[model samples]
Target: MFVRIVKMSFEPSNIDTFLKNFEIKKNDIRNFEGCRFLELYRDKNTTNIFFTYSYWDTEEALDAYRHSDLFKGIWAQTKPLFNDKPQAWSVDKLESLT
Candidate 1:
């Protein structure tokens, strides 16, 4: 499996709006085909920063989701709320302790 991690920095005032939208769309994202898992993490010291950790079956699966309407809608709502450009990483899982 592969993991996708996205780091997002949001405008302080837009955090709540982003969270609400994420809550509404989380289920759909987790249930998307080839999505093995999904998680969201907020930086402990930086309230405006967040990360999305997700597992996918393959790179093609991820690309499919990226091109879907669901992603488009979600991005449209999300992109405008960011204070800085989002950063993402796609990597193969090398180990898991648990």
Candidate 2:
């Protein structure tokens, strides 16, 4: 399994637009092939910051989604709202202490 996290900071005045766009695309993204889980998070103190957390069955699956038209469309609607460059991390399960 692969885990992906993306941290995005939106221009303060554009937050609502970003949220609405995200809301529109969330289901399609979640239903994409190989996507096992998906979530969105907001920073408690940094009100303009948000994160996208997702799980993919494999890296290839993630790569496919990244190259897909769905991503292109959503990103086109998203990039203009950014206040800073976004950051992303891809990881795999190593172990769970519990």
Best by TM-score: 1
Clashing pairs in 1: none
Segments in model 1 whose C-alpha atoms lie over 4 Å from true places: none
**lDDT by residue (tens digit), candidate 1, 1-98:** 89999999999999999999999999999999999999999999999999999999989999999999999999999999999999999989999997
lDDT against the true structure, per candidate, is: 0.98, 0.95
Report the alpha-carbon TM-score of model 1 versus the true structure: 0.98
For each candidate in turn, the TM-score is 0.98, 0.95
14, model 2: CA deviation in Å?
0.8
Q: Assess the local accuracy of residue 64 in candidate 2 as a C-alpha lDDT between 0 and 100.
A: 96
lDDT of 2 by residue, 1-98 (tens): 98999999999999999999989999999999999999999999999999999999999999999999999999998999999999999988788596
